[model samples]
Target chain A: MISIDWYLALSAILFCIGIVGVLIRKNAIVIFMCVELMLNAVNLSLVSFSSHYGNVDGQILVFFSLAIAAAEAVVGLAIIIAIFRNNFSVDITQINLLRW
Target chain B: MITYSFIFLAVLAVATALGLVISKNTVNSALFLVLNMVSLSGVYLLLQAQFLAIIQILVYAGAIMVLFLFVIMLLNIDEEESLFNKFRIKYFVAFLLGVGIFAQLIYSIGSFSDTLPVVSAQMAEAGTVEAIGDVLYTKYSLPFHIIAMLLTAAVNGALLVAQHKTKPLTEEND
Candidate 1:
């Protein structure tokens, strides 16, 4: 039997990589991608725990998370487009108009 | 066999995630992210979350990635720009902090290695499409409806916000 611990460890590593990516990446879109990665990591752990407990709640939660993530992608990408339209750049460092 | 599959998929996922983060071109990053999502869907299948696995591919790999690609092309981002913007001390400190957190997590999880209960077959089978559908429409029906409304609102709002601005051409008269 493949232990749940392996899945949990994988989830944790992926989450950390996402965190590091968020910290170091400069592009707004790449940052958004990192956020998605983090969300995926969470979903992995949720499914792992669901399987561990032998219940449907975790998978149900994953379903909801996936839906919400899609919605977020729509809104977030739209916002990114709007920003790009005005600024002519998607670099996070350069788009600091609100950095008072 | 399952263990090997898990390792392969996990490695694929992490590698693509790294590629997504480091690739200079926004389009390349988006492509790498798609790979990551597909690998994750495979992981979902291994976990016996069959419905979620399909949804992961359909919604995330299919829908969301296309959306990202559209945005990437629409923006027409220049690829000549440097991938890393700033290499300041603050970012280094943040990296160190992240590593610390990762170490702590591994240690904490490692300590409880033997305590996790083996999953029951009944619970494992509960991840089926039928099982999820029954529960979703019953116990989670209200939340599901609310989410549907929320998605509708989000679509409308995105359309409204992304609509092209039409400013009057003041210089045309000159």
Candidate 2:
């Protein structure tokens, strides 16, 4: 039988992988993708817990998270596009204007 | 069928994540990210969070990633052949962060060996759909409304930002 522990473990592993991607990837857009990955990982964990506890709280929380993620993605894409248009590049290294 | 589906999705998710890392082109990375999101949605289904799984596909794979693809299309990104240049320090920092997180996870798993057996039966008498609506209305109603407000503000902010095209100040000086 498949176990919730196993599901939780998988979610944890995915979360770590996403964290690595966010920390390591040099492209700003890739970093944004990694952020999405991390959010999904958290969503996995939330679903697992909600199911395990027999409550709908997890699902509702997931709904809120999805909304927040959508908003974040829209805003992030807009900012990145603005940056890309001016610099003619997508690599995070080149957009170091914030490094005062 | 369940086991096979889980294995396939798990493999696909990891592979696509690797694809995201190895591919040099922005468009390719975005595509891989979409693949990863799709696989993740499958995982969500296995967990019985059907609503969440659908939202995952619609929001992440459908809506947000498409926006990303369009931005990639609109930008000056050419097919990058080589990305490993003089940016060694950034690579090192990312590597360290990954490794550190991995180590912490391993240690936590090791310490959790005495965990109680995972309860197989979900306790709530009501189904997942019903329970979720109840909690959202009762315990989490305040936060739910607040999140809606936050999302509205974000949409307005994005629209405002997109419309403001700040031309070069030098051009304005003439």
lDDT of 1: 0.86
TM-score, per-candidate, Cα-based: 0.92, 0.85
Name the lDDT value of residue A36 in candidate 2: 82
Q: List the residue pairs that clash in candidate 2.
A: none
Expressed as tens digits, the lDDT of each residue in A2-88 for candidate 2 is 666566666667677777677666678878887887787778778777766666767777788888898898788777776776786
Task: For all candidates, state DockQ relative to the true structure.
Answer: 0.72, 0.55
lDDT of 1 by residue, B31-95 (tens): 98899989989988888889999999999989988998888888887373777757687578768
lDDT tens digits by residue: candidate 2, B35-124: 988998888777666767777888888998898888778774747756544567767876787778767865665564433433325633
